[model samples]
Target chain A: EDKVVQSPLSLVVHEGDTVTLNCSYEVTNFRSLLWYKQEKKAPTFLFMLTSSGIEKKSGRLSSILDKKELFSILNITATQTGDSAVYLCAHLNDYKLSFGAGTTVTVRA
Target chain B: DAGITQSPRYKITETGRQVTLMCHQTWSHSYMFWYRQDLGHGLRLIYYSAAADITDKGEVPDGYVVSRSKTENFPLTLESATRSQTSVYFCASSERYGGRDGYTFGSGTRLTVV
Candidate 1:
C-alpha cells in the first residue's frame, strides 16, 4: 500500500524561529509531492514539487522534493503567529493523492 | 469568481439515514474529486470522476456513492450513515490530471452523524 508518513507530529516555537516539517513516502508510481496549510475550514495549496533537488518557494515558506531519498521537507523562515497551522504533505499518483498524517506547528508570540 | 463549491456546508444526520453532499464547479473542469477529512488523518479520497458519466472508487468508497452525470456537478451520497462517517467533506476540481497541477478545493462540508 502507498504510505505517507510525517514527523514531529506537533511543534511549538516562538516567533521569528525557523521550523522544518518532514514527510516520507512510499508509492508505486511517484508522480509529484505537494504541500498544504490548513487553518480552519479547508486546506490551502502551498507548493508542488516534481523534480528532485529543485525547491519551490513562496515568500517565507519553501519546499524541496528529494525523490532519491523518497522524502520532502517544508521549511518556514522567520515564522510568525499567523504561520501556526497544520502542514500537510501528500504523494500523488495518477489523479489521486495519498496524504501524510500532517504536522501541527504552533508559533507563539 | 470561478471555483469549486460545495452545498450543505454543514449537516447533521442519524445512523441508517441517507445523505448526499453536493459539489459544483463553475469552471467546468474535467476532473472532480471527493475527500473526507478526519482528525490526524488529513484527507482521504472517497471517489473521483474523470469526466461526465465516468466515476471510480478511491481510498475509502465503502458506504458511499458518487455520480457525475454532468460535467459540472459531482455528488457523493452516503447510502446508510454511520457515526464513523462523521467528518468534514471537501470537493475539489482540476482542469488537468491532479498529479502535476494539483487541485482546487471547496470550502468543505462538516457532516455530523448522531
Candidate 2:
C-alpha cells in the first residue's frame, strides 16, 4: 500500500517565524511530490518537486524533495498570519496521489 | 472563471440511501479525480478518470461508482450511503496524468450520513 506521513501534525508559531514541515512516502512507481495549502475551503497548490536536491520556491515558501531519503520538506520563512493553514504533502504514483495527514499551522501576531 | 465546481456543497443523507456528488471542470483537463477528506485522513482517492469513458478505482471505491461520459464532467455515486462515508468530497482536475504539474480542486462538498 502506498503511504505518506507528515511530521509535526500541528504547530503554533508567531508571525515572522520560520517553520519546516516534513513529508515522507513509501510507494510503488514514485513520480513526484506536491504541496498544498488549505484554509477553510479547498486546498490550493503550492509547489511540485520531482528532482532531488532541486528546490521549488514561491515567495516565503519553498520545498525540496529528497528521493533517496524518500522524503520531502516544506520551509516557510518570515511567516505571516495568512500562512496559518494546513500544509498537505502528497506522493504521486502513475496516476494516483497518496496524501499525508497534513500539518496544521497557526500563526499568531 | 470557474476552474472546477462541485454541486450540493453540503448534504445530509440517511444510511441505505443513494447519493451522487457532481464534479465539473471547464479546463478540459485530461485527468479528473475524486477524493474524500476526513478529520484524521488528509485525502483519500476514491476514483479517477483518464478521459471520457475511461474510469478507474482508487484506494476507496468499493461503495462508490463513477462515470465519465464527458471529459468535463465526472460524477461519483454512492450506491448505498453509510456513516463511514460521511466526509468532505473534493474534485480535482489536472492537465495531464503522472506529471509534475499540480491539480486544480473544487471547493468541496461536505456530506453527512445518519
Candidate 3:
C-alpha cells in the first residue's frame, strides 16, 4: 500500500502572508508528484513535479519535489482571500495515484 | 464542453438501493478514474479504466463497481448503497499513460445515502 502524509492539516493566515504546505509519500514505483487546489467544487491542477530540486510555479503558487527525501512542498506567496482552499498532494506510482489528507488553507482578508 | 463532466451533481439514495454515477470526457483521454472524497481522507481511488474495456480496481474498491464500455464514458455503481458511502465522488481523465501530464477532474457529485 502506498502511504501519503501531509502536514498541518489546516491553517489560517491573513492576506499578504505566505503559507507552506508539506507532503510525504512512500511508494514502490514513483513517477511524479502533483499538487491540486480545491475551492468549493472540482479540484484544479496546480503543478506536477517529476524531478528533484526543480520548482514549478504559477502566479503566487509554487511547488517542489524531493525524491531523495520522499516529500514535496507547496508554497503560496502573498496569499489572498481567493487562495482559501484545500491543497492536495498526490503521488503517481505506476498507474495509480494516491493522495494525502490535504491541507485546508484559509486566507483572511 | 471540452472537459470532464460528472452527472447528478447531487444525489440522495436509500440504503440497500443501487446507484450509479456517470462520468464523461470530451477530450477523448485514454485514461479515466473514479474517486471518493470523505472528511479527513482527502480522496481515495475506487476504480480506473485504461481504455474502453480495460478496467482495474484501486485502493478502495469494495462495494463499488465500474465499467467503461465507451471511450468517453465511465460509470460507477454501488450494488448496495450504505451510509458509509456517502461522500463526494469525482471523475477524472488523463491524456497519457500514468497521467504524468496531470489529470483533469470533473466538478464532482455529492452523494448521500440514508
* lDDT, candidates in the order shown: 0.91, 0.93, 0.93
Q: What residue pairs clash in candidate 3, if any at all?
A: none
The complex in candidate 2 yields a DockQ of 0.85
lDDT of 2 by residue, B1-114 (tens): 758999989999999999999999998999999999998899999999999999999998999999999999999999999999999999999998674568888999999999
DockQ for each of the predicted structures, in order?
Answer: 0.74, 0.85, 0.85
Native-interface RMSD of candidate 2: 1.0
Quote model 3's TM-score: 0.98
Candidate 2, residues A1-109: lDDT per residue as tens digits?
9889999999999999999999999987788999999998899999988899999899999999999999999999999999999999998888788899999999999
Ranking by TM-score: 3, 2, 1
Which 10-residue span in candidate 2 chain B carries the lowest summed lDDT? B96-105
Better of 1 and 3 by lDDT: 3
> Once superposed on the true structure, which residue ranges of model 3 sit more than 4 Å away at CA?
none
Model 1, span B18-59: residue lDDT tens: 999999999888999999999888899999999999999999
Interface C-alpha RMSD after superposing true interface residues, each candidate, one decimal: 1.4, 1.0, 1.0
lDDT per residue as tens, model 3, A30-69: 8898899999898888998999999998998999999999
How much is the lDDT of residue B113 in candidate 1? 98
Relative to the real complex, the DockQ score for model 1 comes to: 0.74
Give the CA lDDT, 0 to 100, for residue A32 in model 3. 90
In CAPRI terms, model 3 is classed as: high
